[model samples]
Target chain A: MIRKSPMKQENRQTISGADFEEYFQPQNLEKALEIKAEYSDQIEVAAGTTDLLVANYEQLHQIKNWLDLDKIDELRKIEILENELHIGAMVTHLQLMKSDLIKEKLAVLAAAAEDVGSPQIRSRGTIGGNICTSSPAGDLLAPLLSYEASFKLQKAGAERIVRAEDFFTGPKRNLMEADELLTEIIIPLTENEREGAWVKVGRRKALVISTLTLSVVLEFEADKIIEAGIALGSVAPTPIRLWEVGELMLGSSLTELDYKQLGQEVKARINPIDDLRGTREYREDVAADVMVRALNEIERKRG
Target chain B: MQITFTVNGEERELEVTPYTRLLDLLREDLGLTGVKEGCGKGECGACTVIMNGELTASCLVPAPQADQAEILTVEGLGTRDDLHPIQESFVEAGAVQCGYCIPGMILAGKRLLDENPQPTEKEVRYGLSGNICRCTGYAKIIDAVMMAADKLAVEGSDSND
Candidate 1:
């Protein structure tokens, strides 16, 4: 017989179940909002429940009420409107990866999502939950911001659309209200002479937060740059579009540019911090490099 | 809460509180102990189960939220008398280590094989990436999943024949 180690046995230990209160599976956003407004902070809105369960285990107690957003039909939808693509908050990464609209219009967004986790995690985790966490290094935020996506947040009595740029306040923080649910992340559906991409350097391939990530969207008019958007993550307090870099790339001859100057402009934009993941200088330097690489790649494609 | 869902093909009702995780509901309330919880958090995939054809961490799923969904725990996949292809491959390839992560790995493999029977080695690896087995170094598990994929494919082909 194989001897099982102590840690393995402990990890395998069957947990004793507990008795708790009732849960409300709200079928619609209205019902979810009603429960949220009624319970206030006590009402936990869960789609995948990945973050919520870890938070609950630390306390090991019964939550009075839960607003199960999984039953909300509208939140699980994906649609393309008049030159716009609207993704419901409950849309999982797996769904996004499989969407032909996303594959064509928002390739960068889908690429960033492919790095989120394993397929199982993709099936369970939602795009909204990533935004709700609102970390400066939120993986999908950079690409979403690059597309200039707008977000529609809804509360019981009020609703608002905020640009993805202004949505986050700080690390793990957002402009969300107590009663509001992140209903949709809205983006343009144009596939002009424009292309975009999301790139990251993480510790490991899977299940690792990005050391730094870049999302670059490019639009051109006959080999001359018409529009450009450059967003950076994990190199600042919040994910942001490097407007100066975008401005530099907007009207330049992207065909065969050396990128030394464009690279310097990007380097001037970010203020990364030193942490266990990497050094500030390293992140900033690598971030500048990633931007340059993305720009050059897009420019080469132009050629 | 009165929760009714198809558990391992049997329609069963479970009276669970809002705070109870699905891992607990399966192990305690329903008395199906094949599901294990290594990490109460989602980081570890020890408590994985099939929820409406999707592989999800039972530790993260709330019990009441599982209502009306078709849930398949490890017990439902197969028995010792008639092992599923994935389960049989695990035994054959010596993939059973401490066996804590086995249930979740097997279920994940089942879900992946069910969806794509001819998945490549990389696909199989990524499919069961959620499940972590500290022992066995993943060689035999990968081999088992590959073997199972072939077995299932052959079986699927045979059934058609």
Candidate 2:
């Protein structure tokens, strides 16, 4: 006979089968936020439960009561506003890949979503979970940073917007308060003609954490780069915008030599640490190489 | 929590803890052992199931989250008397060796075929990337999926005729 451990018995008692009213699944966003504000410290907000479930299974997350947001219809809308694309936080990566608006306006984001996990993961993993997890190697972060996305966070009755660059403070840390729910992501759409490229170097072709990822967006004015945005991932504490590299590329027509210099500068700017996926030296070298490749691809596409 | 969901076409209501995973609920409470758990993590697709018309790793789904969801497991595909086209193809192509990963592989193939009736070899490999078949080396599994796709196409046309 198998004996149930004391810890398991205590856990079962805490979440007894007879008391099945612990899960709070609010159908509307307002109600969900109200619950969040009320039980800010005790309740965990779950979207697709892709990352949350995994963390809970690994015993990393101990929160038992969850405020499931999957039933909230308002948090799953993807709207193309007048000059920006407003994506609901609950929009899945698969949904992003399938959206025509995302494909046309935010091609780099769609590409990054396509390279996320396998089909199963993409089907359930949401942009909200990705942003809230705030992992250094989050595949969607680099592209969103490159696009200069901002988040719409809401609590019970108050709301605030935060730039994506400032949202992530460190690895697995963000600016979201305990009661604030990230309701939407707003990405500004450029009026001028522009090209974007995203490249991720992982250990395998699929379902692997990115060793180094790069996203580059360049706005052109008659063959010269008038504006540029560059974001790098997994080589820092959080996905970081390479402002220096973007500044260097501004007002200049990109050439092979310019890309080479920019790649080296990116390598010098980042402070990568040794990890299981790769050593600091490997990431430093390959981050530059991948940035150069992304620039080259953007250049080729521009031509 | 008391959750009600559709399993294989039948509605099921069960009382489960907040921490129970969909995989455990299916294998233990529902007694559907067809869904295997190779890795508790989502790294392996052995726990793959069709949830709400999308392929999902059941292990990564909390039981409460699947409250109103429609789930399809390997047992829902067909039986020994009437096998699914994919299952028949697996047998014909000798894709079943250890048989540990075949259920998830067949579900992955079903998802691929349901979306794209005729997928290329590369698409097949990409579709089944999450599932790891250490026994067949994936050559026979690919063959099985291709054969099933062909058979499904013919059946679809015949039904129209």
Candidate 3:
């Protein structure tokens, strides 16, 4: 005997049978923005869809409108304009890894991109999606924050630039409005002698979420540290720039600096929790260790 | 939603639900079983496919986003009668222990070899890092890829001559 349960039927109905209302693939950013303005709250703007499609299917099934940004050529550009590197939000990790400009100016970001999930993930994951997803452990976030990158957020007729430091609210959260789309990332290029390092520790070399990530960029003026940009990921709610550590290192010579003291300050600044990848204490411990190691890399490079 | 894409040199137009993933669309709708779904999340590269000349996890790609895109699957590589060099190398090197991860491994090797015709052993390991094979301990798989690279290089030189 065949039986039909009421609860099963209702659950299937609530899931809507995996049917979505609309799917929009706009060729240009203008049409994309128009669609965004119209269905701001209803649309799910996908950049690469690497993380989006991997997310809960129930949420995706509930989506009223799907906006695919893959067709927007304007959003996939990487250009250098007037001392700033303008990378389109849809630029994939593979593009970043293979880009000559990124390798020349932002080797740290390229290193981070190379360490991301796998070749397949790197081919599909984008910098914009990395920022928008806003995972505290995002591989690229540490490098981005270290470079003082800013995002270009666009609505239909309005656009605003938000600094990387101020963009994140918490894990998997950002300062983006429902109507706004992240269009580009602008990193101001400096002419000074700059050396940077990206050091990440994970369970395995590939296809593993990082346990901790450290990005350090040091600007040197003939041996003395003119400026230091130190950022750590997976140690805080969001990938954070160590303002105290930066303040401590400014105008101090690397040779005369107190490595042990700086390590303590780095440990003190971050607040991590026990997760599957690592324990809170382990993250706090390595947070300092990797910082010192990354600084040492910068020191070695300076020589 | 309807998406038109080229799969393995053949153009296919199909009606897929908006929530459908490219993995499902390929396997269920298109009947390409070479693509496997081990982990729906991007961690496992079992569903890896070359989409528009790039290695991408089909599981993570929404079906609607594949519109007018070019895709390549393991089935497109070679038939049973005539095996691709990579497949031949895999069989010759005894890299097919479980055989579940062979498709993704071969695709990874293909992309790697396509970009770097002559890759070092370290490079081969790095290139195939995305694929996870539970059997054979990966030594044979790496050897298979290296052997395939040599075969592909020889074939290229012969064609040129």
Candidate 4:
């Protein structure tokens, strides 16, 4: 049996099932944004209802009026535009796996989706939820960050694209306002034809929270790496894209020796804290180890 | 809250709590006890059900969330008269020991086979990992999956989808 872990709250909020009411199910993006403008503070938008349930457990009444993003047909689409892959907020992990476009365009994303909680969780969990929730150890964010991802966040009457690098402020902390909802996660569809992979280390495989995870996107010119984008999760306040390490390996032959040193250098970039998953020092060490293993596998496959 | 859904090909409408789980709705309101609640969380696949072509944990799904969705439970998958091939494989392979986890295991296995008709051993193991059996009846269960795969391939009703 899965034990219930208490969350941090000043006082628990309780809403009876009898008190439950479904308020918003906007069919289109415009209507959803209009409702967001109207029901500003009380409304909580949800796609999968996974993260919201966790947050609701923490603060009982945090979800009083639900704006069901799942019902918004426009927000539930996956489109490949001219420059980037545009995945709507309501696109479930299962849908991503079924998309041949995802497999051909972004294989690392498909691999990361495969690592999310389990088959059940994957069916409901969305990439939008993964990014908007801003969990430091979220399975999908590191990979998205590795792809130089951004989000198209829509508010009452306006929208802006925020790069993944500037997306989150801290653990469970995002710049998302009460009125703004994430419409789509945008990843530039690279025509350069590079290969990327995601690796996660958790206690167990299914329904386990990731302890340390890494995503590496490498662009190889002939036999040398022209570009490398590496991101590490569960090692910082937010999942971080390791620009320094990527710059270090920009123009080098990625051998086993180089991978070992890069792992140590990536370790130096994070400030992991002691939490329920692992101690700070343990996370730091495991972060390095997972990175090394991930880099090794990617390099070996590249060869 | 009044909720309506197609359960096991039959349309069902019921009054339930918004917090009331789909598992609870199926067992209590509808009186279909096939869907078990081992872990009242998403971790356990005991409450697994195919909701609109995707297998999901019924425990985490609120009754309101399942409104207007098409759901298939273990009871609906096979009847006493005509059992699903996966169910038949379970019976033929002697996969059921305690029978407590059979419904869930069968549901998970059915979903796996539906998605990947000819899943390898590793794929089968990963698919069934969500459903736990205390009796350690995994070997027979694996055999059942393989047997069902071969049968489905023969029948051509396989999700070749």
Candidate 5:
């Protein structure tokens, strides 16, 4: 329940059409970068507009000038290169769920995408917008983190690739510079066969933010756990990779006891804060319980 | 900004502010009151509409986002004289209680049938998960969509035969 402040409404000026300086719909990447360079601070680059429009409606964002990126065809492509699967930043959740490449290679990501809002929300919500929002409870971030995804950020003259784990600096904040735009996500394909699962515990079946979420990716070699990636969300300031627990499980045949220890370790490591959705204690407990359940599910599948 | 888009199969050009949402544009500018605004946010599907053959929450969509896109609202579904099969099914199933959530529910049903003609009970429930109806307990709503699918399938096969 968001409380509307009467004083805030009174302070807002009635914005009319004349007040908008410009609405730039860039046709190509070059033009979009050029506009970004010129008015980086003044403009807001919109893709999907799922989070942005909601913020604007809630009076949380005061954006004026617009750079609509929906027309840029290159940013919406999902391609499979030699070494990695390249997902354009503008690719919507529905597109991700429908992609055979994603289903075959990144099954965890596909599952997470399917768990997102609803059919209507998924049609318009993009992977880029999800990353940009950087919410601690973002459904895709945990899966992407577990998959070791990297993001390509582009500015007017140069671009850089950053690891998904390093992209977040804090809640609702990332390493994106003022001039840089997140262009693509590259998930490197591994030689090792990986089995993974994504589980999100929310208030309801649909359109509810997660109270706690877990994404587990385990690589096995002949019934021995060769490698593992464990990521947790909504129990910390940012979605975090449980490296210690993953390291502990490596090279060991995971047993029921190992799963229990992993759950206890996860409960110890997470830093949950009390909030409206849940208490700190509840989140802490659920995080461990879900992590154990996910590992058990993965182990069962490996057989 | 002046934008041109096809609404209900008609080309419409309107000068709207950059901040204008599609929900406001539909209800206020175009006078299409059939599209309800339950929650200004995307949580509720009351503002659901089919844009470019995909279901979208109109409230979260900015007005310029609809430029050159074909939009289908409740008004486009059917007329009072000739209700769409799904709409008629809702009437036959007694799916309406308050009637506030019917438009979105009908649109969701249309999208489901368009993509999957023969949906299971679980699929129907998942298809309409975005829509929330405080009344009817959703059993009748599911029945309505299932009934519509059966009727459409029979009619479709009849046309081919």
Candidate 6:
């Protein structure tokens, strides 16, 4: 049931130029899915509303309908069920930083959330929105890709899971259907000891979009690297995982691995472009440099 | 669309368009002009406020989403006659220059102190990093927050006595 607007409005105001024909806030996921299925083409799904209202405010006038998912409490939960950590799509960056569960298991993801825009942005920007926006520079993308997270996309009565690595089609583009809503992100809980780091290079310390971001998560078995996930952002059309580089590190300790060769492989895998934040050559060089430093730091910590 | 929310401890009901921003709603309708609009985008924290006990950029909040929420703008902190501890500390440290960013700075400081009663210099810097001050170079702003933490600590002990 739609909550009716209360009658008593003491301070009534109307913006002249801006208009939205309909605003729907569904209290539950079931109702939200119905609304999305009905108004699939016209409605915009709003979680934190940061990108829609701030980053892309210029396009607000063209938006005719809104499907605000704020009231759906199911999308705001962060829980661990059995061997998986289920993070609701509406979980904000601030929430991720404060979650003890996230800190213990997926600290690298939390670190990325901490590097996101200032306190205000973190408080309002949701991880699901970050994934949906599909911005290559999105702080959470590199870490999410590194963690091998999966997304739960729902429409009407059906839902499907998409791997985080395969969800993005291009910069500012994703594989989400018009009638689908990203409901939760499922990350498998690992029992192995893990060490990781999130490094972001930007113009200024705060409120600066990243020029380049690197996330490396290494699973160690008695100092031997059994599994590794290395990902880079802002160096390609989509955030990419260096599968070949990761393969080279398997079963080899940092001392046994060739740093020079691994760095060269990382540089060769990424396809960067010249933009305002950085030049293609600079990103390529820094990507290699940051990767080595991050891995070295991890090694030093393990020692 | 219509939205109902509490601003600075005062509850009010209002009619707002779907695209109407909380910044405009607070400034134009309620006359809380202390919430400045430096950068309409979320990059600059000049339009920062406390919503649902979280630091938020009012410019980025859609008015419709503010329904049934509690918001605290700079006006809610204190008046000129009786200044909030943060505002007083800013003045004592000469943290205000152009004053366009002070309201947001003051609110950010308040939010920080509310969470962390005793913040270190590094913590203060991290807390105020979101709000940029063009004139004072941020040394004094950091000092003000540190001072406020001390002042609030003393005030809390005195209240107990």
By lDDT, the best candidate is: 6
The collision pairs in model 4 are none
Docking class of 1: acceptable
The CA lDDT at A1 in model 5 is: 25
| Candidate 6 per-residue C-alpha lDDT over A1-303 given as tens digits, one digit per residue, 9 for 90 to 100 | 233333224433333444444788889999999999999878888999888886567566567788999889999999999899999999999999999999999999999999899999999999999999899999999998888999999999999999999998899999999999999999987888899988999998889889999999999888789888999999999999988899999998878987777778899999999999999999999988898888888888787
For candidate 4 chain B, which ten residues in a row score worst on lDDT? B12-21
TM-score of chain B of each: 0.96, 0.98, 0.98, 0.93, 0.98, 0.98
Instruction: Give the better candidate number (1 or 2) by lDDT.
Output: 2
Model 1 Cα lDDT, one tens digit per residue, A1-303: 221112123322333344333367778888777777777776677777766777678553455566778888899888988889999999998888889878888888988888876665777888998888788877889998888999999888888999999998888888888878898999986556777767888876666678998999887677677778789889899998887777766666665565776777778888889998999989878876877788767766555
Question: Which model scores highest in TM-score?
Answer: 6
**Candidate 2: lDDT over CA atoms?**
0.88
The true-versus-predicted C-alpha distance at residue B133 of model 6, in Å, is 1.5
All candidates: TM-score = 0.90, 0.94, 0.93, 0.89, 0.94, 0.95
Leading candidate by DockQ: 6
DockQ of 2: 0.45
Cα deviation of A149, candidate 5, in Å:
0.7
- The TM-score of candidate 4 is 0.89
Query: What tens digits encode model 4's per-residue C-alpha lDDT throughout A1-303?
Result: 222223113212333445455556667889888888888877877678777665564242345677777667787778888888999888988888778988778777888888888888899989899988899998888888888889898987799999988988999888888888899988887657487778888888878888888898887776577778798788899999989888898767666347778779988988889888889999888877877887778777777
Residue lDDT tens for model 3, A158-265 = 999999999999999999999999999999998888889899999999998889999988887877788788998999899999877888888878898887788889
Model 6 bad stretches (over 4 Å): A1-21
- The best-first sequence of candidates by DockQ reads 6, 2, 5, 3, 1, 4
lDDT per residue (tens digit) for residues A119-231 in model 2? 88999899999999999999999999989999999999999999999999999999899999999999998788778999988888888999988888888887778878899
Q: In angstroms, give how far residue B18 of model 6 lies from its true place.
A: 1.2
Error of 6 at B151 (Å): 0.9
Give per-residue CA lDDT, model 5, range B21-66, as digits (tens): 8887888777788899998888889899999998899999887888
RMSD of 6: 3.2
- In the order shown, the candidates' DockQ scores are 0.28, 0.45, 0.40, 0.27, 0.42, 0.53
Worst 10 residues of 3 chain A by lDDT: A1-10
